[model samples]
Target: MKSGCQWRMMPKDFPPWQTVYDHFSRWNKAGVWECALDKLNERYRHSKKRAVPSYAIIDSQSVKTVYASEERGIDGGKKIKGRKRHIIVDTVGNLLHVSVHRANINDTKTGVAVFERAAEKYPSIKAFSGDAGYRGTAVTFVEERLKLKLNISTKIKDVFAVLPIRWLVERTFAWLNGFRRLAKYVEILTATAENMIRIAMVRLTLAKLP
Candidate 1:
């Protein structure tokens, strides 16, 4: 598909299709894709019409990887070879931050990175919502470092209090899955995998424009 696009568009001066594909392949390996996503998110924040986010949602999803090595480790939860995508989404389901880690990495560990990064990037973010997996140190880190509040959604009598807002983050995950690349894991390197995710998000932001 990429080769065909290059052939039709450039026709005469185009570099070899394999070379172009190789560049993208290499960029993914080096984590350029994820960096691109970060830049896009930065741009989005600067140009956004809404006021700063008062809250965000946090969660992790498991994606299956075909090339599993001793380095990546095993995921007992999914029972498949893969990695975890830890993401933070805003009240409107817009992605604010993300981290990719080995499937075996605990959700709480990745949660720290996600919140810290988000706090650094968007200082106005004041609160976060998530499940019990984010209960202990995860809650403390956000409070101590980010100086933000934590709102955990549990099966309590006050479920109604949390349901409306918490769903935004879940909806964001569903929106991200709309991109087929995210639906299946294909990248060889973690950086490249993150780049695809960033691209999907940038595309989403652009789509929302008038």
Candidate 2:
């Protein structure tokens, strides 16, 4: 995944590409990647003397797709025809959850689902922060329904500045960019795409452990 090498093009001296893909596909469908990320995350947090995250940053990135990819759409705002990766990350830039979907869907419409899913898994999170795109009823849903807070920071016009909290998620996106496979959403299924992201984060967390 780091090299973005085609499965069949993988060099010899390793397990056959078919065997490797078989395990990846099976584990992705079984949520093995998510479990691995969670455990590694716990270990990393403990090593840092940090408790479970109390707040998370949420954002989405739209990327183009291969011609034969499935379930695609155009993000008119971003003017990209592909898919959006909706993700929530902890304050220090650790990814907490990810949801892949059609790019055309507005962030406010589906952003809450990712937050809710993460909240259910990590009940300690008390609030979230995001950009202006996530404004509207989603804010109410977060504060009123879930009884959590959502901070929406509008970008400063005519100037460049990295807004606090929100920048952590942007940085996480930058970290994902280091993995060449994430250069584009190349998976046939959105689930597979999401799993690929989880695997990347798991590898990142492992690097920080003993």
Candidate 3:
């Protein structure tokens, strides 16, 4: 296939393109990716000797797509193109939740789902940090449903204070980009794209294991 041809030209040794493609496709079909994320989250919770995250930082990023058919028209606002990636990261920068949707979905709308899911999984989250996009209902839900305080950065000064802590999640995303499959939006199905993200996270965690 086309992917195999691209792999052949690369300098490093890799599994046959067909094998990589098939593994990813099968895992996505079986919902194995989500299950893997849950497992990793549980591992982090149980293995940590100190304490669970008290504050979490949430954000979304836009990943551009080359194929028009792959693009979903979710009013990306000023950045009106590609898909949206919603991620919730712990204060220390470990990923807690991740979701992918069409480009136009409001960040607030998705924030609730991410918070709900994270609370159900971790149950120890006490606070969350996000950008202004998460101000409205999302903030309300975190305080009411999850009983966690919300800290959303708005002004330049607040941004400066939170940027250092927030960079952990961004760094993780950068690590994900090392995988060629994530370098570009190649998966036609949304589920497959999510599976790729989960796989990258699992691989990253395993690499860090002592």
Candidate 4:
């Protein structure tokens, strides 16, 4: 899946396309991918001298879906028809939580889901940061329900200056983009797409280890 080639286009040296897909589907359903990601993430955290993240950052990206599916919608702002990936990352850019929804969903609405998912897993997470898009009701919802500080970093005067704190999540997104399959939301199922991200994180965490 990482190769970005169509399953039917898989090379002869690889396992039969159907065989490979069956394993992928089965593992996704069994939550093996998420478990692997959590273990690898713990290793990466220890490598950086941290036990768990004290705070997290949230962000979303809209990508165009390749096939017609009920999981897609039009992102009027980006003008793309597909889905939005709402992801929360730690200070060092490790993924903490990820949720997918129709691109048309507002950031504030999905922000709640992302924070709740992270809060459930990481009790140490006391705060999170995001761009102006996460301000207003989203900020209030997270703070009230999840009891996490929501920092809204406004744009700076310089056109090219990177925003503080929030940039970490953006870098993580870039890291995920390195996996060609994630360059677009091609998976027919939302869970499969999310599992693909976990697989990419597993590869990243392993690569960072000596």
Candidate with maximal TM-score: 2
Best by lDDT: 2
> Which of the predicted structures, 3 or 4, would earn the higher lDDT when compared with the native?
4
**Candidate 3 Cα misplacement greater than 4 A, ranges:** 1-20, 37-48, 68-71, 74-80, 158-164
lDDT tens readout by residue for model 3, 1-210: 113225346435767767876776787888787787666755665566536766778887777655653546545475656677788877545678788777877888878998888788777777878878898999999888788888887665734453756677767777776777676665677766677678778877766645
Clash pairs detected, candidate 1: 33-195, 34-195
What local lDDT does model 2 show for residue 68?
73
Candidates by TM-score, descending order = 2, 4, 3, 1
What TM-score would you give candidate 4 relative to the actual structure? Answer: 0.95
> Local distance difference test, per candidate?
0.73, 0.88, 0.72, 0.85
Residue range 144-202, candidate 4, lDDT tens digits:
88877888888788587888888888888888888899988878888888888888888
Error of 3 at 33 (Å): 3.1
TM-score for candidate 3, residues paired by index? 0.77
Name the 10 consecutive residues with the lowest summed lDDT in model 4. Answer: 63-72
RMSD per candidate (Å) reads 4.9, 1.2, 3.9, 1.3
